[model samples]
Target: MARITYIEHNGTEHVVDVRPGLTVMEGARDNNIPGIDADCGGACACSTCHVYVDPAWVDRLPKKQAVEEDMLDFAYQPDPKRSRLTCQIKVTDAIDGLVVHIPEKQI
Candidate 1:
């Protein structure tokens, strides 16, 4: 399992141990971290799972794919530099201490 941190817009923090092969979205939902709706259930078909990758960990993640980029266009207040759909990010041992910041809203 990888230890990941989720920080909410209002400054709440949730640190969870996420299993490998699961997406970050799953980590939030399974751990009951608020703000990640995952309306499409990690299908990458919706933007409700949007979160901002911590600047320090952004470079360590895989580059965004075209589908994720397109879906992010529907996200509220999307930030190209940091906004990401948690569903697109798979948890792995390599990212043991990953930190993600939740946006103010998701729809």
Candidate 2:
């Protein structure tokens, strides 16, 4: 399992172990983390699971595809360099220590 950290806009932090092959959005949902709403589940069809990836781990994550990039355009206060959709990020041992900060709200 990969250990992932989800930080809320209010500074709350939830760290959980996520099984490989699942997306980051699943991790948050399973752990009952409040920030990511995942309105479209893991279909990459919405930006409700948007987050700001920790700068330190940005380069370590897999590159975003066109679909994910397009969805992020609808996220709240998206940061061009750090915004990402959790549904698009697959969990793996390589990203075991990944940290993502949830935006203040989802739109």
For all candidates in order, the CA lDDT equals 0.95, 0.94
RMSD in Å for all candidates = 0.6, 0.6
Cα lDDT of model 1 by residue, 1-107, tens digit: 99999999999999999999999999999999999999999999999999999999989999999999999999999988898999999999999999999999997
State, as a TM-score between 0 and 1, how close model 2 is to the true structure: 0.98
Residue 12 of model 1, lDDT score = 93
Pairs of colliding residues, candidate 1: none
Clashes of each: 0, 0
- C-alpha TM-scores of all predictions: 0.98, 0.98
Worst 10 residues of 1 by lDDT: 76-85
